[model samples]
Structures are given as structure tokens and as C-alpha cells.
Target: MGNYRFILSGGGTGGHIYPAIAIANELKRRYPDAEFLFVGAKDKMEMEKVPNAGYEIEGLWISGLQRKLTWKNMMFPLKLISSLIKAGKIVRRFKPDVAIGTGGFASGPLLQRATKKGVPCLLQEQNSYAGITNKLLADKAKRICVAYDNMEKFFPKEKIVKTGNPVRADLVNLICSKEEALTFFGLDPAKKTVLILGGSLGARRINQLVESKLDFFATHDVQLLWQCGKLYLTDYEKYDSNTVKVKAFLNRMDYAYTAADFIISRAGAGSVSELCLVGKPVVFIPSPNVAEDHQTKNAEALVARDAALMIKEKELDSEFEAKFSGLMKSVQDQERLGGNMKKMALPKATEQIVDEIEKLLK
Candidate 1:
């Protein structure tokens, strides 16, 4: 293994941070002696997570611009200037062979400075619709790794590489049986299991839907394994019982996937990739709060291929019961969705992304 130095930057949410960690882990596996440095926004999740993953990280005084006029929006220019200066110093001091970005506010300045220094850079765009950070850096990126097809509209066609998004390596192959998973979660094996996920921080609407529909699940003989996320755990944990298991986060996602017969999830790109590998019937309620309504676009890509079903948040109040009831009752629909999702699984995404990184190193 070559003892090369590398820099990675991404943050704000688990969708961005986890992919960066996954790529770092893959590179570590291949080059045990290589040095890795992570750059992320100072107050974001990545500051804590990167260190937990066993890598040293530096934080930039940066944040995304607010959509409305606010104090934070006013500070964007100053923050960008400060981050750019710090990123340049970090790049010069680290002297990384290659810099990689998984989309986030911090990556914009980090990659921009790296490119100016004549360093090779690669960008991993997780969403079907590219984020502003990735779009702005596309011209200078030596290779653009992507999870979805036809990313030519976002990045240069020649540089685009459909390597897919990196997900947790442990989740790529699950060996837990349904019965074991049911026992682990203390649910009845006879009942259909539905896993609810609204990303790591949780979704308010999803939590409210589950709250109102607790009886709906019980009457239908379906067990609920709800990940309420950290944001709303206190508000919803009181409803947890034998039939419904509510948690702030799921540490053993492999076991959760094994227990689930069906899934209700937000359509973040990383979640979509993991769900595809898990091969379960999924109903995506793409969070309407994301950039460019990208979560909806991500879910649509699968829905178009008949790999999954989608229920927009706006229509959920009127249409959720009918759509959800139909899905739960039909074994044929469940099998078809699961089969199609499995076909779209890219289990080797982490390896493939590392392969692209290696190419740039060469």
C-alpha cells in the first residue's frame, strides 16, 4: 500500500457525513498506512463523527446560506472568505495527493482551494439532483463519482463516473433471518413488520403520521419498528410498546433491515442506496424540505423503474391511508417492489468509489 496523504470534506447531515466516512474506511482498508484528514463545518455533525470513525479532522467556520434574509444569510460572505483561507492553509500544510468531496457547504471552499493548488480532486455527488457545492466544483473536479445515471446534465460528461454512493459496509450483506430479527426487536413473527425511517434527525410529519396511525398498524396486524430520530424521540417515545418500537437512532441497521418486511422512509440518496441493498418493499415519503426537492427526484428515479412507491408529503394527509393500505395487503406488490429494488442495488459502491480515487492517485 502506498503511503499517500488524502483530504476529505463533507458534513451538515448524516447523508453527507456517512458517505465520507465510508469512503475513508475503504481507502484505509486498501492502504493501511495512508494518512487521512477530514474537513467539515465547525458546528456540524461531522466534527464529532469523523473523530469517532478514528480520523483527525479540522473544522471550518462555515455554513450554508439561508433561503430567507437572516443574520446567518448576511454572514455567508465572511464565513466563505474565512473558510477559504483556512482551507488553503490546510491544503498547503497537509500536502494531500488528492482531495475528495461528498456534497456539503464545507466542501465548496476545501475543493476550490485544493484545485487552485494544482492538486487532483474528485467529487461524489449523492443526490440524483446535484447540490450547488458539487455543481460549482464540477469544472475543476478531475473525476466526478455519482450514484445516479445521466449526471452529464450536472457535471462534465467526460469526468462523470457512475460509481454509486458509499454505504455502511456491514449493511452490504445481511445474514440475520426474519425470525431472529423479530425476536431481537421483541415483535411477533406472525405480524407484518414495517420499518419507519425519517433520516437521522427525524421528520415531524412522519412522526405525526405514525402517532395518528398507531391504531391503524395494530388493527392491520402489522408491527412497527419506528426510528423517530433524535429530534423527536422525547415526544414520541411514550407510544412505544410490544407492537411498536420507537427509537432515536438505529445502531444495528442490518438487524432492522432483516426485521422489516416493508419500509417507510425519506428519500435521501444514502438511504435509497442502503434500502436497495436490503431489498425490501419501500414507500418513500421524500422530505419536501431538501434542496431542489432532490429527495423527491431521488425517489422518482426508483418509482419510474417500478422499484418503489412514493407518497408526497403534501398528499399524505388525504392519500396516505389508501396508498399504504393497498401496499400492506398485496403480497404480489411487495414482492415486485423488493425484486426491482434488489436489481438496482450496487453493493460494491464503496469499493468502486475507492477505485476512482486510486485512479486519480495514479
Candidate 2:
């Protein structure tokens, strides 16, 4: 156990990448002398993000099967073969004691190879519904750590551990006090602030809703920190008024969360976990564009519990204003939403995950 060696594989999207890194960071903190390696899809976001996170990474030539029947399907077999060969080589060379998979095509071949090497492989599943890669690796996974409960439906009951997903360290650590957060974002300390996030890539539908409702926000004296993602429809300054601040990405999410009185966002699992930590009154506008329509399912799981509110991506353009405005008008209702959400927070997910990894090694 003192000679700890670990491998982590996940990513294609930030949802998978960030959690994988969060788990890795925790493990590193626990075992500072441990050797760590990341296996990720070639040319994907993880290729860049993993390196930026200060870890060594090996890339596998893997991508998800295209949803539609297309020429891309023809390349799947070749990519599968190439990825397996690459994955096997990486596993054999690193000789990891334990392997962790978050979710993504890259994780499939890598974890499969690790299992073949008789390494202890643990799978961390972030969604309420299991992902395709996690499903494929289920039989090989020695332990399964999941964010949602009742996942015996997805994995062997014996392997399931109801450990929550690892959220970003910076997020769980409040970076700014309320007054500092208010001034940093240029929001009025006296006025309630609304934060709008649409993932790191941004959601077109959510961005459009905010664009149309700028004047409506001013009417309420509500300040906004709108994360428009990269698909900024128009110059942010063009849409800028006294009440709205629009940016492609919000690097200082902690401050945004601190200043926000209410929030609107797509219900990607990572964001959901972070919100549970922040516990702000939120209106989740789940993106219908995701694989398996999982975002909607994630939002519904919370909305059904009366912990949060949800709107459809299709309905966001139509219903967001009416619903959000109604919620914002009621201070008591807002407090209730915030309090219920806070009750759901698994602030120790990172610590719990690290403990599990330590137990596995022991």
C-alpha cells in the first residue's frame, strides 16, 4: 500500500473530466508518493485538460459510436482495436494497483485492460442513470462508487457503493465572502443576484432566454452573471445593460455562486453536485441535447423530491421567465428551495472517495 500506483480514465466532456480530476487530486493528497497516470481519448478535451491538471496522461484512440447510422460507424471497429492495443500497452507499462473510471469511451478500453491485468478497478458513476462506458465496465469493476442511490438496477448489488460524486475543491471552498462576491461581480449588494450557467460549452436555448429577458430583469432590479458559453450570439457588450454581465465562461464560479441569490442552469451531473454544495435557489433547465437525455433525468430526480425546480430545454425559451420570475418574487419560497438543496449536499464526497481508494489499496 505504501508503494501506491494508480490509473484514472475518463473524459470527452467536462462532466466526466472534472470529476475524474477531482478524484485524482484527492488520492494524490492522501498518497503524495503515489504514482498517477490518466488514460483519455486522443484529441479530446481530456488530452488538454488532463495535462493542464498536472498529471501524466496516455491517449487511447477511442470515440463513442455515432448515434446515427453513418460512415463513422464503419470506423468503430478499427478504433476499438487500436484503443485496446494502446490501452493494454499503457496498463502493462504502468502496472497500476488500482484503476478508476469516471465515464467516457476512453475509460472502457482502459479499465477493461486494467481488469485483465488483475488490477483493482473502481468505477465512479456520476449520473443517476448509468452511462454506456460504465455499463460495459460493470462486470470487471471490483467496486462501483455512485452519486445516486438504488443503482443496483445498473450494477451488481454487491459492487454498488452509495458514495457521492467528487465535486471541485475550489467550489466547495468558498473563495469570497458575500460582500466581496457582490462587489467582484459588480452586482448591487442590496439587490438579489441571479446566476445563469449553461455548462462550460454553454446552452444555446438558455442563452437565448436570458438575451430576451434582459429588460425584464432590470424591472426587478435583479443582477445577473450570465455564462453565455462560446456561442455568444452577439457581442456581450452589445447586450450589456446595467443589470447584466455576460461572459463565454465563468472562471471564478465560486464568486458567482457566492453572489447569486438564485441560479438557472442545465442539469449536467457535475453542475447538479456543485449546486447541492452551494445550495442556492435554482431553476434547472436541462439540455435535451445530451446523450440518453440524461440531463433531464438528472433534473427530474431532484425536482421530484421538491429539492429544486426544473424546466425543459424546449420550454426554457418559453417558460423560464414566467417560472423564474414567479420564484424570485417569493423570498420564503426561495429560502425553502435553498435549504432543501443544502440538505442534499455531499460535501465530503472527495474525502469519502479517497478513503475508499485507500481501503482498496490496503
Q: Worst ten-residue run, lDDT, model 1? A: 175-184
For each candidate, what is the lDDT?
0.93, 0.86
lDDT of 2 by residue, 1-362 (tens): 45589999999999899888998888888778889999999889999998999999988888889989988789999999999999999999888989999999999999998899899889999998899999989998888988887789889999888778788788877867999987887777888888999888778777778878888888888888888887773645477555778778888888889989889988989999999999889999888877888888888888876779998866666677788888988888888888888888888987887777777784
Question: Per-residue lDDT for 38-125 in model 1, tens only?
Answer: 9999999999999999999999999998899999999999999999999999999999999999999999999999999999999999
The whole-model C-alpha lDDT of candidate 1 against the native structure comes to 0.93
**RMSD per model, one decimal:** 1.1, 1.4
For each candidate in turn, the TM-score is: 0.98, 0.96
Stretches off by above 4 angstroms in model 2 are none
* TM-score of model 2 (CA atoms): 0.96
